[model samples]
Target chain A: GESVGLHLPTLSVQEGDNSIINCAYSNSASDYFIWYKQESGKGPQFIIDIRSNMDKRQGQRVTVLLNKTVKHLSLQIAATQPGDSAVYFCAENAGSYIPTFGRGTSLIVHP
Target chain B: EAGVAQSPRYKIIEKRQSVAFWCNPISGHATLYWYQQILGQGPKLLIQFQNNGVVDDSQLPKDRFSAERLKGVDSTLKIQPAKLEDSAVYLCASSLVASGNGGEQFFGPGTRLTVL
Candidate 1:
């Protein structure tokens, strides 16, 4: 069965520190990956995305790294802030642009 | 622009009961998606629609769950004889199209359903 999973269910970080959340995917043919952030009572919002053609992509204060060989994806947040506390979900495009999301990783940033 | 709109921010029902949720996607968005999100888990795709047509419903539990997007603008998801396991957040999202970039979805504040 095709599935996506996270290495950790929760990640806590201190203010101004860097945080890393990891995801493992089972589909090698998966071509696109995305990171979404969901705040309490809000829907998930797009953070960053990386295509299989690229190994890394960066956004305002976040970066997404894709390792096709290992079927792993990681999201790194620099200078974590209290406002960054939320659940982060990693989605993989299995086929036909249908994205399958993994169990989310709760990121708690302490200020 | 206004984000996706969902009605009845929260609903509480008992097992064997019925409930319906409504959604209005962003203007001009051709793709609409419904998802179920359990606590501590990611959103699971229940169905996907493209302009009033069903694009995908592979994960939908047809015996109890049904959805429609008749006008290509608004959609309704109905669940009959809901079960306790059906307690979860119902999220509605919209995208311009699935052709490029997986259509970067824009989501609405989800409707939380509690089945006791």
Candidate 2:
């Protein structure tokens, strides 16, 4: 079965520094991708999404970069804040009605 | 507008017992989904519904789990003879079918189940 995976399980960054999380997907047919942020004991919240047609999409202080050539995706957070720390997940939809998710990356911001 | 809603913030049940979780999607949304998230993992789609009909349920454990969206409004998921491994957070989400070719999902607070 095809799978989506993250390069790291945990990340630590300074409160004011930029944060980058990486993900790799196995299915080439995946045309849509989404990034979700989940706080402790809460459901996932939509962050940003990118279609296969575009390479990048920016929203607020977050940017999603998609490299279809390598089946890689990344989420970049500018000026990281305490509230930005959470578990991030990357999901891929490959013509299927449902989306598959990655293991998840735990982001920790140091004050 | 209200987001997706789920009941029983937390549940503790013993093995072989039955449990049911409820969900209410955003008003007027045509697409609904149920996902299971284990600790340290992302959400996994269990079932999908379009209106009152089931769109996909390939990942659902049909032997022990069943779901229905009555009147295409609210939905419920029931797990009969639950096992210890069934413990996880159940999340319900909805998306507007008219938003885009690939709609974005809005999630609920989730129901955390702990099987003892």
Q: What DockQ, on C-alphas, does every prediction get?
A: 0.69, 0.62
Model 2 lDDT per residue over B10-115, tens place: 9999999999999999999999999999887889899999999998999999999999998999999999989999999999999987223578788999999999
* Deviation from native of the Cα of residue A64 in model 2, angstroms: 0.8
Model 1 scores what on Cα lDDT? Answer: 0.93
Give residue B22's error in model 1 in angstroms.
Answer: 0.4
TM-score of each: 0.98, 0.97
The digit string of per-residue lDDT tens for model 2 on A7-71 reads 99999999999999999999999998999999998888989999999999999999999999999
The best candidate in terms of lDDT: 1
Clashes of each: 0, 0
- In TM-score terms, candidate 2 sits at 0.97
What CAPRI class is candidate 1?
medium
Residue A1, candidate 2: Cα error in Å is 2.4
